[model samples]
Structures are given as structure tokens and as C-alpha cells.
Target chain A: MIRRKILFIGLLGSLFQIFLGCVPLTKTILSPGSPEDLTTCTNVFPVGPWESVHKIEAVITGGVSFSLLGVTRGDPNKRRLHSFLLTPEGFILFEGLLGEDGMTIQKAVSPFDSPAFAGGLMEDVKGLFLPPPGKPARWGRTADGTRVCLWEGPDGFETEFWEAKDQDRQILLRDDLGEVIKEVSLKGPFVNGLASYIELRASKPLPYKLKMTLLQISP
Target chain B: MEKTRMKRFLFFSIPIIISLLSAEAGSDQEWASLKEAAKNIRSVKSEFLQKRILPILTKPLRSEGRVFFQTPGSLRWEYLNPLRSVMLQKGDTIRLYHFSEGEWKPEMTQAVEVRRMVIAEISRWFQGRFDESKIFKNLYVPGPPVRILLTPKEGVDKFIRRIEIFPGTRPGVIERVEIEEPGGSRTSIEFRKTEINPNLPSEIFEKP
Candidate 1:
């Protein structure tokens, strides 16, 4: 009995050590290749002026609901935009424009506080979908298994690039502080089958989710 | 001199005569019945199709969806084709979703103008009462097709110019609704296959 107990404990120790080793090694494995490897890569970036419909399911702090709609393209830098919210039967609940400085939401049903609500929303959206300006300033690995490249701007505005191993595309982001102020992830064709999903998380939670799907690639 | 006098008399008398005739034709009972129909609708569910035309594009992009509304303050609008999206409103909270995003964002509901318009219209609808004092100056006119024209009052004119509701030949049913905006944008909804006051799941208004 004494010998069996000792053997069991030894086996458990070995297994624990193996798991620890795997976890640390996984971080390194996710690192991007040298600059030369990126140069030789054949992937092309997705350009915009795109539009697509999305079905959103939100579970925030345990509250859950669903919404549906389509979004049209505009530059976050320029901040001009158009989109529509529709019912399952094809009625337009709200329609509006998000422009450089503000936004307007019209024809909303109950619980929707149009113009004021939409203005803040468009700002949050711009942060998430637009890429960082200027240049990348820091390059390193995050403790949580991502290779990161960061760019810092005035007013605490910063952008990050996270790379995952065996993944063809990278995540481009603009953030304020630690919050994910704005971001776009590019998954390789393998994950979405030749299409990409762009996710924009609001700086503050809003009553809507905005997503873009790549329908076709244009040169 | 008699001919000249007669011409002057006819010009002034004709408008007054026409005005008197129209005033006599405007019966209060017809207006009351229309208001009753407008206010009595408790809930509504309908299918919709939206076609977007871009200035540079050759073909309009089309989408089909569904809309649901319940009294006091519950609404669910979802688009099931071309893409999936939904907006659900229950009480003071509204949630919108894009399935591709896989998340629902919370929004605030404090702004008054748009909210008030919606609430006022909905409450009136549930009660089956159409109050012109709140939104428009109501007019009932015989048309190429019979319709009720609601011309917006002062404050409401910024958004809507007029709305026309056409009752079905069968009575008590809304056959069509047309909303005209000040910007020349018009939306016309033709209600078909309507089911009124049907049993609807309470959870439909709850968060998903």
C-alpha cells in the first residue's frame, strides 16, 4: 500500500509539471514570425465601403436579448455612416446617419431614445472599427499567449496588434487605457471560409451590437 | 354695369358657398369612428421587405423581416433574411443585436422627443383612439381611394408631414398605412394576413 501511494503521487507530480510547461510554451508558440516572414506572406487586407446584415445576441451581466439589422460602410476617421434597423417582417424600426461629429436615430419604437443615444453609440463604434493612426511603437509578447505590437498617441489613445499562431490574420485595435476602445480582428480564410467577421465592442455597453461580414474580396 | 356687378358677386360668393358645403359635409361621427379604429388596435405583427437603392448602384438591395408590437411598451423587430438582426424593446430598456457580432449592446432611453412620439402613438393605438390634438389636424376626404389624412401639427411637422390610414372594406381592419416625412421620404405599409389579439408569448418581450 505504501509503495502504491508513493507511485501515484509521483505520477501526479509529473502530470502537473507537464501541464505547467505546456501553458508557458503555448504563449511562445503564438508569436508571429520574423519581419521577413510577414514580407513573404501572400495575404491581402480587407478594404471597405462594405455592407452586411447581422443577427446579434447579447448577454450582458446576465441580461440577454436579440436584435437584427444591416450596417453600411464609412471611415471611422471621417465618421460618416448610414445603417438601418428592421423588423423580421421587413419594417424599418429606425434609420439614421452617423457623421463626423454626431449621429441621428429616427423612428425608434419604445425604449429607444433616438438622437442622444445614437450619438454616443456612433463614437464608441468609431473607436472599435477604425484602425490606429501613425506608427506602431512597441513590439512584444503579452503574458496571455499573444504577440503584440502597440502604438501610442496623444490623449492616452493607443492601438495594439495581437497575433495568434496558426492564424493567418492579425487583430488591429485602438484602445483607451485597458478598455478595448475599438478593434478589428482578421481571421484567416480558413476560420470563416474566405470571409472575415469584424467585431466592434462599445467603450460603454449600448443597446446594440455592430458586426460586419466580408461577402467578397475586392482588389 | 349689371354684368360687372354679377361677376364680382359670383367670385366672392362661390368660395363662401364651397366652404359652407365642405363644412356641412365634415361629420363628427365619421371622424369618431376612424379615431376608434386607430386607437383600438392592441397589438400588431407584420412582415416587411426593404429595398435600398444606392445612387451609384444598378440594382436595389432587398431584405425581408418581421415586426411585432404589444400594448403600453413592448416591441420586437427582427430581420431574418439577407442577414439576421433584431431589436427588442420592453419597458425602459431596448436591445439591438447583430448575429455576426455575437453580442447585444445596451442603450439608454432618456431622450424625450422620439420616445414620446412612439409612446403616444402606441398608447393611442392600444386604446383604439386617434387623438388629433396630440399629433395632427385630422381630415377625412373622399379620394381616388378612400383614406384619412392626418396632417401634422406644429411640433410634429419636423419629422412627419402627414400619414394616411386606409381601412379595409370589411371594416375595423387597417388595410394600409402611409407615412410621409418632411424630407420627401415616404413609407407605405400594406397589412396582409393580419392576426389581431392572438396569443403571444410573454417572453417575446423579455431579453433573449
Candidate 2:
């Protein structure tokens, strides 16, 4: 009887640990290669503050779907227009504008006010358009031959930018543990190296994907 | 010369008079009865063009779609060009779908709750309950296709600068809805052709 109680306690401890482990995403293994020039690596990703209008159709799979007109501006890092979130039925969900003075939100309809969702949203948008924090720390290529550029951000986070041979660019924002918390992919029909398709995947906390298709790009 | 001028004036004036009379007929009916008239409408299907003009955008973003609505609660808002998405609502349940990664995927659960609110707002519009919200001041100008202008009150004024509604060719049918933003940008949804009280299958409300 005493042995059974001890085994039950051990099982409960394992379950609690598993629940805690689910907080972080599955760590992605990185392959090393020869260092390359940072400027040559980010040739495909859009830089500078320019407006991009896209038909944003967001789906959560078995939940609901909505298509709206989204306009994103600015470079990845600093102050930028971020992205304007709209609903298909002509309603403005929220207007996210990132200026030099942090970020400001207007017309946010309820859910965006939450600390978790709003923070996650801002991170994803910044991950997709803006450049990583600080400068490029290193450059290399993955085992899949996808060119990788790593930028060491504050608090020991590594933002990696990957580019395929075919001008397709992918961004992986990972923490110190090598867990890719966020992944952004910019893909083809490159018009002067600007991607027509972009997808952002958030892996930690709550996993969600935002896919944006370009309708028009203005320099 | 005087007779010819009088004759021309009469010709234009008669059509104007007739249009005013028809508009008066619409306005003379009680607003509640018009709400009842809206309930009389069984189903509606119309093709629409959505033009989103913003100050940041160099050109207006144009999209095409179809809008479907049924009395007592059902709506299918589908967009075809540029992007494909469908928002369907039947009674209390609302389902939305988008073409993602070449497959139809649903949207976030938050949108479902939002849709419920939107569906309620749309239902109020369908019932012709102009006084439903204190946020808008509804106006009407007499004509063959009467004009209903809705100007939003204070807090809501920033987002929805103005809303203009026009009656359809069919009596008591809605023709167009135009929403303008504060910065001269607007989203104009023009119903090219509209079908009123048509028999739409239940599958029409299902995700396609």
C-alpha cells in the first residue's frame, strides 16, 4: 500500500512537469556553415518604411476565418506603421502603429486589450516586417542549404533570417534555449526581390499562424 | 419661346414629382411596418464591389464579392477576388472560412464572438430599426430610391465617418451601403444586381 502511494506521487510529479514543459515550443536544431555578409543575406527582405497592401485572410483551423484589407509599413525594427487589422465586413478591428515612442493602438475591439494577445500580436507583426533588434550578430547556412543570418537581440534572444536559393526568405526568432518561438517565411513571385506571399507562425504560449498575401507594394 | 420653356420645365418637373410621390409613399408607411416589410423579404443575393481607399495607400484596394442574407437570421458574406473568404451565419451559429495554404481553414474563436455581435447589428439593420442605436442619427431624403444617411455620434464617429444607404429598385429592398472614413477614404459596396425573396438552399449558408 505504501509503494502504491509513492508511485502515485511520482506519476503526479511527472504530469506537472510535462504541463510546465508545454509552455515553450519544440527546439529547432540549427546547422552551421561559413559566415557570409549580412547585407547580402537580407537582400530579399523588405527594408525601409514602405507601405504594402495585402488581402489578409486569417484562419485558425476549425475556428473561424476572415479576410480583410491590411496595410503594413516601416522596417522590421524601430518605428513603423506595423499593420492595420480589419474585418472582412468593413469593420476596423484595430489599428496598430509602431512609432519611435513604442507602439500605440487605436480602434481595438476588446480582445486586443488583453496583455497576452496584444503582446503576442505586436511581436508577430514586428517579426514579419521589421528587421530584428540591433545588428546582424552572425551569418551561416542551415543543413537544408537555406541561408541563415543570426541577429543577437537583447536578453539573449537570437533572431535568425533564412533564405532559400530561390529568393524565398524565412525568419526564425529563437530564445537562448534554441526554441523557435516565432517563425516567419517570405516567399515567391518576387517582384524586384519583394515577396508576394508572407506567413508568420507563433509557436509558444498559444500557437497561431498569420498568412498575408501581397496585393500591392509601394516603395 | 415662353411656351417651349414651360413645356420643358413640365417634362422634367413631372418625373421629379412622380419620384417624390413614390418616396412619400415609402415614408408615409410606419417605420414599424417597414420593419415588418423587411421580414417579408425571404432571401437576398447580390454581387458587390468593395473599394477601400486609405490615405496611406496610393491607389484604392478593389475587391469583388457576393452578399447573401435571409430573414429571421442568416447571412453569407463571400469575397472572391484578391482573397477568398466566407462568413456564414445561421441563427445563433456563425462559421467563417478562408483559403489558406490551398485549403479551407477556419478563423480564430474570438471572431466567432465578434460575428455574433455583428450578426446582431446586421439583424437590427435588416429590421429597419433606425432608432436601435443612439450612436447614429438616421436621415431620409425623398426620391424614387430614397436616401438614408447615418452620421455616427461622438465615440464611434472617428472610425465610421459616415454611412449612406440607398433603397433598391424593388420596393423596401436595400440597394447600396457606403462607409467613409475620416480621412476621405471610403469602402463603397455597390450591389450590381440584387435578388429579393429568392429560394436559397440551406447549403447556401454552409461553408463552401
Candidate 3:
């Protein structure tokens, strides 16, 4: 009987590992391209501490939908207005503000009350707007000719910002093992200094996504 | 002693119960008549002014829009003021569009269930099924325009404080809706130039 229990336990452990293996975040050798390429790739992006209030409408594919008239003010850390309405009819889904203190969920409906989902959103927002956390680990180009700058964050987590010719910028946050955790892409032109559209995709936890559109920006 | 306590409970409860029954008798009749009248409306088209009050703001933000609703689940909510945004619900799916840069782009609106539920409730109002709705408990208020106060009956009650809907001179036509939020502030949508059962194009429900 004990032997059978051991076998079942081992099977469960292996299945869990396989589940974790499915998230795709691959790393490659730093592409040492021309000096001009590195400057162009990293220069187009904005450096923090930027503050703006954008009328954002975001939807989570099969999960959630809401429109936000929010004020996003932040500098060294991210400050976000956690408010949204389940649209068409204007049903309020959540109303709160989030900062370094984690998510202060003043109002949230069921399923959205989870802290991790909000935390993941803040992480994505920071990744898209604010410059990467630390100094660039390597400033180079990708094999596909996309200019890429990799910033080594704490705890083996790295953020990569890449901008291609005539294309909007893209950001990748990866774990130490080089597995991609979050993929964020900016669409539309940088009006003044902010992009009008942003899409975030997370591989782990669950297949989650948020598409954000900018309405207005201010000082 | 037990018998005396039982007698005391019945004596106090009877008057309270009687008053409650009398209130329901009057209220239920009003609701039943309103629902019966609403049953005749097939569609509605109206222009609305929507104002939202957020805590972060010093003043109420203003927006202007038009709303279209059809019975059995179809709607079009278009905002054309400070910015252009369109929301449409057909069957069980919801589609959103926003004008950005120079053209209209499709927005991801996959939260179909919530939107569906809300649309269902709104559509039922036009269909004259107010008393049959699972979302709210309706109370009739005496007014020159006639008013129905709705308090959400379920989890949605957490987000909504109360909804006061005023019907037009024509039976079953809703002219105004004032939705009170949890924070004491409310959003008032006033419908003007309301038309019912007009010849509407099938194309109006299409994605932008």
C-alpha cells in the first residue's frame, strides 16, 4: 500500500513540473550590433518618472471587461487608479487605487477580488511605461534585426525592450531561467511621449491579457 | 405562561403583517400594470446625456451619447462627445469600438456574460417584464411622469445603490434613468427624442 502511495505522489510532482515547462520565455546570446543600433533602440523609449491620466478601456479576452477613467501618477514606483466599468451599461466592476502598498481593493466584484491579478496588472503597466529597473545587462540587436536592450532586474527577472524600424516597441519580462513571464507590446505612435495602445500577455498562472487604449495624457 | 407568550407574539405580529400586505397590494398592482404596458414596446432609440462623478475629480465629467435597444437582446450605445466610442450587444456577444488616431479599431470585449446579464435586464424593461426580472425589486412611486425605483436584488446590489427610472407620457416609454452609485454620487441618463418601433437598419448592430 505504501509503495502505491509513493508512486502516485511521484506522478503528481512530475505533472506539476510539466505544467510549469509550458510557459515560453527563451533567451539568446547578446547580439552585439553596431553602436548606432543600440542608441536608436534605447533612445526612442521614455525614461521615468512620468505621470498622466488616460481614459483606458481594457478587456481580458475570455475573462473580464471594463473601461477606466483613471489617473496614472507615478515616479520611482507605479501609482495606478484601480477603477473600471463593465461597459455598454456602465456597471462598476472595481474602484480602488494601487501603489507599492499592493492593491487597496476598496471595491471589487467577485473573481476580481484576487490580489495577484491586480498585482500582475500593475507589473505590466510599469513594464510598459517606466524604463526597465536596472542598468542594461546587454544592449544589442536581435537576430531578426530588432534592436533589443535587456535589463537585468532583481531575482533573476530580466526585462527586455525592443524597438524595430517603423514599428511600435515591445517589452518582455522573463524569469531568471530565461522563461518569458509577460509579453507587452505597444501599438500606435507615441503622442508626445506616450503610446496610444498597449497589450499585455502573461504565460504563467493562466493565459491572461489586457489591451489598453490611451485617451488623453497630461503633466 | 407559554400560552400567554404565544398570544403576545400573535397580537403584535398581526398588525405589522397586515400593513405589509396592504403595501404590497397597492405596489404590486402598479408594477403589474407597468409591466403589462411595457410588453408592447419592441424597440427604443434615444439620445442621452451621461454625467459621471468620480472621487478623483473636482467636478462631474460630462459626456453625450445615443442609445438604441431592441427586445430579446440587442443594443447599441454610442458615445460621440469628447471622444467617440461605440458599444453594441447582439445575441450573447458584445463588441466595442473606439475612434483613435484616424480610424475606428475593434476593442476586445470578451466579458460576454456580465454584459449579457445587464443587457438582458435592460431589454426586459422594454419588454414589460419588470416584475419578472431577477435583477431588481421594483417599487412604484407616484409622480406626474410616473416613477419606478429599482433596487438590485443580487450581487450587483454591491455596485448599485438604487436606480430610479421615469416613464414618459406614453406608456412603457422610459424618459430618464438616474443610477445611484455606492458613494452617494449618481449618473443620470436623460433620453430625448425617443422613438419606438421605428424602421431601424439591420446595419446599426454591425461592428464599427
Candidate 4:
């Protein structure tokens, strides 16, 4: 009976590890480029604080699409963000403040009041406004000549930022198993280093997509 | 000496009581007159400017729009600038639309639910029945511009703190509305160039 219990516990642990994708898989590496290449890649992120309004179209996994007015005030230096969403008729759906410690939600209506939804939205705000966690682990040009800057997190996750010749940018976040979990694309006519259009897609937690169009950027 | 003091106290208190009673009576009289005026209004059209004030923002977000209403339950509320969207209601059927890529598209999502609630509230205002809300208790204040204050009851107080409505000099016209939220955020909408008893086309309330 003791042996059977031990076997059962070990099987459960292994399954949990696999579900978490804890085993780090090898990712592709490019040529080690110069310092100027790193600067060019890092410049894609905004440096100063900014307030902007966006018209957002969100599509959930099951073909549920809705529109919202998004207002955000982000300070990259402080790594703090205040964001809220409003319905067309001006009812506030969600309002949250994200700081270094965690997220504090002031208001959240149904379908948006879940903790998972709040965490996912905070992750997206960080990805879009702030730079990666630390210094770049690798900076170079891909085979197609796209500028790439890769940052590796302590959790065995990797974030790669790409800038094309036309100034279009793409960010890919990979989990420990080297599978892309979140993808973000930015197209410019940038205002103060902020993209005029942004699209983000995530597969983890749930499959969702958000397309944001710039409406107003504060001076 | 005690009798003299009592007489003096009554002399001051009686006028104060009488004035308070008259003020209350005057408020009720104004309310009844406003309701009587609403019966003559067949339609109403107006331009509106909305300002949303929040502690998180340095400046209030502004939006401009238009509102149209006809008797027997038809309303068209359209936001023209800063985000183009419209809500049309004719009787029980309500439709929502958003303008994208130079065209209006039907919005069949959860957002329509929020708009429907707003339309229901506006419909009550158009009917001069602002004091008839089951969720709020109405208090009439007779200002230079008479104001109607609605305070949310127990269950609904979590979302809304209060609502203030200012009626126009003309009957059945709402000049302004301010909705205050529990979290120190407020939305103020002011109406302008109001036209009362206009002939509204039936097609204006149709679906997008």
C-alpha cells in the first residue's frame, strides 16, 4: 500500500510539471551584433510618461467581439499604469492601477471582474508600455535582416522584439517550453514613440485578441 | 419674564416655519407644472456635450453628440465625435452601431446591454417621470434652474452615488445631467440648442 501511494504522488507531480512547461527548451540564436544594434532595438519602447485614448476591438476565443473606449496613463520610469475601459454609452466597465507591487482594481463589471482577467490585462499593459525585465541577452539581425533584441526572464521565459525596415514592430513572448504565448504588433506613424496602431494576441489562460487604434495622445 | 421669552421665541420661529412650508409647497407646485407641460411635447432634438472627469486624468475627456426622442417610446442617441457610436430604440426593439472605416456597423455584443440601460433611463426623463424610479429616491430642489436629485437606494448604491438633473425652461427639455459614481468619477452632459415639438422622421429610429 505504501509503494502504491508513492507511485501515485510521483505521477501527479510529473503531470503538473508538464502542464506548467517547466523544462526550458533551446531557442534559436542569431549573430552577435554591435551596441548600435541594441540601441536601435530598444528605441522602440517609449521613454517618458504619456496619456492616450484608444478605440479597442476585443475578440474572444469563441468569436465574441466587442468594442470599448480605452484610456491609459503610463509612466515607464515608475513602471506604473492606470487604465480603464468604457462602453459606448459611457458606462465604465473596468478600472485598474498597476504598480511595482501588484494591481489594484477600483471597479470591474461582470465578465471583467475575474482575477485572471485583471492579471492578463496587466501583463499586456506592461508588454506594450514598459521595456523588458532586464538587459538584453542577445541583440542582432535575423536572417531576413529584421532587428531583434531578445530578453530572457529568470523564469525561463524569453521576450523577443523585432523591428522591420518599414518601422513596423513585433513582440513575441515565449514560455519555458519555447512556445510563443503572446504576440504583439505595432505599426507606426508613431507619436512620441508610441505606435498609432497596436494589435495583441495571447493563447495562454485563453485565446484573445485586441486591436487598438490611437484616438488622442496628450501633449 | 418667562412668558415674554416664550412670546419672543414664537415670534421668530413662526415666520421661519411658514417660509419652509411655502418653499416645500412651491417645489411641489413646480413639479406638477413640469409634468403638465410634458404632455404638449411631441418630440425633442438637441446637441449635447459630455465631459467625463476622473482622478486619473489631468483633463476631462470630452465627447459631442446628438439626441432625438419622439413620443410613445422612440429614441436615437448618437455620439458624433471622439468615438462615433449610436443607439436607436423604437418601442421594444433597440439597436447599437459604431462607425469604423467610414461606415457604420451593427454592434451585437455585450456593450448593447449597457446602452439599453441608458436608453431606459433617458426615456423616463423624456416623459417627465424622473421621480418615478424604483432604484432611486428623488429630491426636488428649487434653484434658479430647478434641479432634481436622485439618490440610489440600497442595492444600487454600490455603482451610482447620485444623479442630478436640470430641466430646461421649456417643458419636456432636460438641460443637463450629471451622474456621479462611487469612486469619485463623474460624467456631466449639457444640452444645447434644444428644439421642442419637432417633427421627427420615423426612419431615424431604425436599425443601422
Candidate 5:
């Protein structure tokens, strides 16, 4: 009887371990990574007008969920931005400019202005969809099991790129303060794959989140 | 003595309980009637006071606007207060106008994916058919002011968690609409002086 009870307990322990292993974990932490180093990324073609739908959520300062439909074209040096607002029901509430140098938030559904709101957002999208302008200054491994690449730009912005073992591409951008001003992750660049889904969080107290999904990409 | 006191209390509460139950039933009936009334509305034209409350802000941003819709295909959403902007959908074309530019810019609405989605939505609204199956799961509740809560379908956009629409006791007027996003951003719009089928001009959609 003693041996039988022990075997039963061992079987139960194994079953519990199996169940725990099957449970999926949601990752909230944002890490830095590179585009070419990404294993699971869909091959993003560098060409004309592209559109995408993205699910956006943020929790650093506060929490909000919204989806954005984005359109972009032209080289990274000169890109045009346009976007539309939709309720989760797919109801079109408003249409606004995504990225224009002189955009004014004349009427926002939210209190934040367009430039301050879209500045960090557009930067994230550009990081994911557009290729890095120059080669990496340095490459190394992060303690968190991510491959990192540091890229320097003409402006005061420093971009760190990292890859997550066939999962997604992560990019961390910061200013001289070493504070992460923005972070982005792109999933799937397969043929006809989603363009690039991005999440952008600002360093300000009134930090905002922007999510972008690939709706359609024109060849 | 305790048993006698309990009997007396139960006897006194009977009438109050009956009245409360009757009031609840009446509220349910009223809500059903309102839903029935909404079914007959073919179109609506209303002037709305839209207030957008931003997080960490002292004042609610305000915009006064007018919305006109003709069933199945035509809609004109114009904002005239604080700033001037217009979105007009006529068959296949959508024109977005900004007062700052002082000119109407014709957008390639069909080719643009985002605009196509907008056009598709407006078209659906024209059909007088709410795609509840895809957009939202609705719940109706009773109160002095009726409340309709719309929870989005699963795997939808994250920007909006739920929306509350309160229709006034009177017909053809929506008292208020509250939109709650996942990030604590809320926007509310209140409508006043609403009219239905008021024979608005087609020129309202056509650029003058």
C-alpha cells in the first residue's frame, strides 16, 4: 500500500509539471534587438506605400488599448504619414495625420497634442518597418539572452538593436540621459506577412502608447 | 415572543416588496420600448457638444459639432467649434477639409487602406444594420437614465475597451456617449437639439 501511494503521488507531480509547461506566459518587458538578427521576422520589402493594423497597449504610466491603421511610403529620409481612428468595433471615429512636420492637434479625441503624441509613436514605427540607416557600431549579448547591436545616428539619438531567439525584433532608443525614450518590437516579416506591429512608450510623465499593424503593403 | 415579532415585521414589509418589484418591471418595459423606437429611426441629424477629457488635465477639451447621416450611403461629419474640419462621404469619394488650409484636399480614399476601412464602416451604418456580432456585445440596464454598454468583440483593437450610449427619454436624441480606452483615456459627447429626417441639403456634402 505504501509503494502504491508513492507511485500515485509521483504521477500527480509529473502531470502538474506538464500542465505548467503548457501554460503560456505573456511578456511585458521590452528589450533591445536588431532587424537582420531577427529569426522569426517576416521579410519586410523595402518599397512603396504600405498599410498596417496594429493593436496598441501601454502600462508604464497608465494603461490604454487602441488599434491604429497606418500608411507610409517614400524613403525614410522623406516619408508621408496618414492614419485613421477606429473603435474596437471597427467603427471609424476620426481621421488624423499620422506624421507631418508641422502637424497641429487642432482637435484631438485625447488631450495630448499630435506632435508630442505622434513623435515617439512614429519613431517606433520607423524603427521596425524601415531598415537601419547605417551598420552597427558594436554587437554583443545582453544578460537577458538577447543579441544587441548599437547604432549611432547624426542626431543625438542612440539606437540599440537586439533579437529574441526567433521570436521578434526589439529596438531600444535613448538620448544622452541614458533613459529609454522609445522601444519597439516587430513581429513577422513573411511574404504577405504583417508589415510591423509596434509599441512606443515615452519617458515623459504623460507617456503614451502607439501600436501599428500592417494592413496592406503595395509592391 | 421572537416568533411573534418576526411575523409582524414580515407583514409590514409585504407592501414595500411588492412596490419595488413592480417598479423594476416597469423599468424593463421602458427599456424594451426604447429599443423598439430606435428601430424605426431611418436617419438622424444632431448638433453635439463633444468634450475630450485628457489624462492629467484640469479642463475637458471641448468641440461643438454637427453630424448628418442619410441611410445606406451618405454622411457628413463636420466640426465647427474650436477648429473647423469636415469629413464628407458621397458615393465612392471621401473629402476631408481643414479650415487651416482654406481648401478642400481630395484624398485618394479608395486606394488608402485606412480610408477604405472608414468607408466600409460608414457604409455599414447606412444599412441601419448594426454588426453586433463583429463589433460589440451589448448589455441593457435600467435606471432613471437608461444605459447601453457595448463591450468589444474579442481580439479587436485595444484602443477602446467599452462604450456607453445613453439615449434620452425623448426620441431621436442621444443624451451622451462615453468612450473608454484601455489606457484610462475617455471621451464623451453629448447631443442636444437633435432632429430626424430634416431634409438637409445635398450641398452640405458637396463642396461650396
Candidate 6:
């Protein structure tokens, strides 16, 4: 009985260590590179203040889809953003401002007047337009020759940016469990390295996808 | 005590309700004339400017479009600038298209009902029976100003506060429509260069 108890405790100890181990993304294994490589990847995010208009096609969970006109103005350097979505006939569905004090929603119509909806929208916006939080712990190339900059948040979540040889880019966010919670693909005729088309797919408490095509952009 | 409160409320409210009814009844003559003018309209084609005002916008967002309407429920409404989209209706069938990548693509099926409602309202306006909306109480306001006010019924008021329609000097022509939301946001559409009974191609109503 004493030997059996020792074996059982040893098994539990090993399980605990495995649970606390660094979780690596199974698909992409990144090797160490340099700070210059990280800077090149960061340029994908816009710097300073800019305003943009986009035609957004959204497919919500259960396959319902709709189109909206999205107008956003943000100074990513200051972490301030104002955005609104309008129907084609000019009905405002949602309008919100994100400042130092966090998000404040000015107006939200039915189906959008929820706190969860507002938070999700802000998360997607920040994910696309702002660089990931914290310095990248790993800046390197993936096994497939894709340039990558990987940041690990204090909470153990991971953000990975990958730039393919064709100049297309992707941003993937993984939970502490190592499951991809969100993935964003950036492609199109880029101006100054800013992509004109963006596709964001979020899989979490609920799944939704937004396909945004740039209509206009200004400084 | 509650009974007395109810009694006092009715005592004050009954007279106000009567006066309001009388005021609407007085406008029946103007309503009949507007309807008469509408009967003369065979078709209408107009360029329109739409302005959306919201507290978030520094200025109203402006868009331009054109509308084509024919008798017996055939219509085409096309936005020409900022975003290019078209809504077409013929008989009971409705179609919506969006311009993307230099080509017109059909919009999703889920959003068809919402677009259908807009087309339906435009149809009612062209028929000069816009006041007959089931969701709103049409209170005709006879004016040197001349406009129709549509106030939403109980449940509908949660979405729409009111809608005001201004009739043009020409018979059966609508000068503008202003939609007010429960919030301070408003949308105004002003019609310009209106052409009445112009020869419009059938394809305009059939295709986007």
C-alpha cells in the first residue's frame, strides 16, 4: 500500500508539471531571429492617427450574414479609437469610442446593444490595427520560411504574426490552452505596407467572421 | 385614492384628446387634395441626397442616389456615391445588389426583408397613401409649410420616434423625408431634379 501511494503521488506531480509547461503552437514552430525582423512585422499595423472607411461583410454564428458600412478613426499611438457601423440606407447600428478610460458606446441598436458585442468589436479592431501587447519574446522565421513575431502575454496567452513570402500577413491569437482563439488574414493592394483588405475569424464564446474591404483611407 | 387619481387624469386628458382629433379631422380636405395629386402621377425619377446626422459624426455623412418609380409597384433605388448599392422591386419580387470589385453582386438572403421594408415605404409614398401606415398614426398637418407627420404606435416607438414627409409644390411629388430615431440621430433625404412621367427603361426596374 505504501508503494502504491508513492506511485500515485508521483503521477499527480508529473501531471501538474505538464499542465504548467510552456504551451507551444502545434502548427508553427518559430526559431530565434533579430529585433530588425520584429520591426518589419510591426509595420503591418498603422502608426499615428488615420481614418478609414470599409465595407464590412459579417457572417455571424448559425450562418446569418449582413453587410455594413464601417467608419473608424483612430490614433493607435495614443490607443484612441472611434467607430460606427451603418446600414446601406444610413441607419446607425453601433457607435463607440475607445479612449484611455476604455470603451464608451454612444449608441447601439437592437442586436448590437450588448456589452459582449461591444467588447468583441473592440477586441477585433485592436487586434487588426494595433500591435500586440508586450515585446515579442520570440522574433524569427517559421519552419516554412514565414517571418514571425510571437508575443506572450502576462496571462500566458500568445499572439503570433506571420508574413508569408507573397507579402500576405496573418495574425493568430492562442489561448493559454494553446488553442487558436482568433485568426486574422491581411491581404490586398497594400499602400505603405498597410493592407486594404482584412479577414478576421474569431472562435471563442461565439464564432463570427468579418470580411472588410477598404473604401477610403486618410491621414 | 388610485381611483381618484385615474378619474382626475381622464378629466384632463379627454379634452386634449378631443381637440387633437378635431385638428386631424380639419386636415381631411388637404389630405384629399394630396391624394388627388397623387392619382395624376404615372411615374417619377429623381436624384436624391441623403444626409445622416449623429452625435458621433463631426458633420453629417452625405450620400447621393437616384430613384425610379412606376405605377403598380415597380421601383429602382440606387446609391451612386460613397458606397454603390441598388435595390430593385417588381411586383412581389425584390432584389438587392452591391457594387464590389467593379462588378455588381447580389446581397445576402438574410437581409432581404429589411430592404423589402424600405422598398415598401417608397411604394406607399409614391401612391400618396403613406399616412395609411399600419405601424404609425398618420397625423396630417395642413400648412403653408405642408407636411405629414407619422408617429409610431406603442411598440414601434421603441425603434422609431417619428417620420416627417414634406410634399413638393408639384402634385404628387415628395420634397423630402426626415426620419427621427429615439436617439438624437436623424436621417434626411432631399429629392432634387425630379422628373415626372419620364420614359424609363424596363431594364432599370428588372436588373441592378
Tell me the spans in candidate 3 whose CA falls farther than 4 Å from its real position: A1-85, A94-96, A106-116, A132-150, A162-168, A179-181, A201-210, B1-42, B47-52, B57-114, B127-135, B140-146, B152-158, B169-171, B199-208
Worst 10-residue lDDT window, candidate 2 chain B: B9-18
Runs off by more than 4 Å, candidate 4:
A1-31, A143-145, B1-26, B97-114, B155-158
lDDT for A172 (candidate 5)? 67
Ranking by lDDT: 4, 6, 2, 3, 5, 1
Write the residue-wise lDDT of candidate 6 on B80-144 in tens digits: 87778889998888899877656777776423455576677678889898666554566677764
User: Could you tell me every candidate's TM-score relative to the true structure?
Assistant: 0.52, 0.71, 0.58, 0.81, 0.41, 0.68
Query: Which of 2 and 5 is the better model by TM-score?
Result: 2
Candidate 2: segments with Cα more than 4 A from true spot: A1-36, A55-69, A75-79, A140-146, B1-42, B72-74, B81-83, B89-114, B120-135, B143-145, B153-156, B183-185, B206-208
Instruction: Give me the displacement of residue B168 in model 1, in angstroms.
Output: 3.0
lDDT by residue for model 1 over B67-125, one digit each (tens)?
Answer: 67776677776656666656677776666554544444443322223333343453344
Residue A128 local lDDT, model 3: 64
User: Model 4's DockQ?
Assistant: 0.13
Better of 4 and 5 by TM-score: 4
Ranking by TM-score: 4, 2, 6, 3, 1, 5
lDDT of each: 0.48, 0.64, 0.61, 0.75, 0.50, 0.75
State candidate 1's TM-score.
0.52
Candidate 1 chain B worst ten-residue window by lDDT: B9-18
Which candidate, 1 or 2, would have the higher TM-score against the true structure? Answer: 2
lDDT of 3 at A56: 56
Q: Across residues A1-219, which tens digit of lDDT does each residue of candidate 4 receive?
A: 999999999999899645433222234446677899977666788768889888888878876677788889988788889998877556777888988988998767656778988778777888888888667888887566777788899998888887878888888888877887888889999997789999998888689999999888875
Predicted structure 5, TM vs. truth: 0.41
Q: lDDT by residue for model 3 over A34-97, one digit each (tens)?
A: 7786555445555444444455545454644445444454444343434443333344444455
Better candidate by lDDT, 2 or 3: 2
The model with the greatest TM-score is: 4
lDDT tens string, model 5, B1-208? 5332222222111111112222322355655666567666666787888765433223444667887776546777766754455667777666665443344433322123333344444344334233342445555546545565555544432444656667676663567877765444566777777876678777776672
CA deviation > 4 Å runs, candidate 6:
A1-52, A58-66, A73-83, A93-122, A139-148, A154-157, A162-196, A199-210, A216-219, B1-26, B100-106, B109-111, B142-144
Per-residue CA lDDT of model 2 for A120-148, tens digit only, reads: 66767666666665557666554666666
> Which pairs clash in model 3?
A25-A180
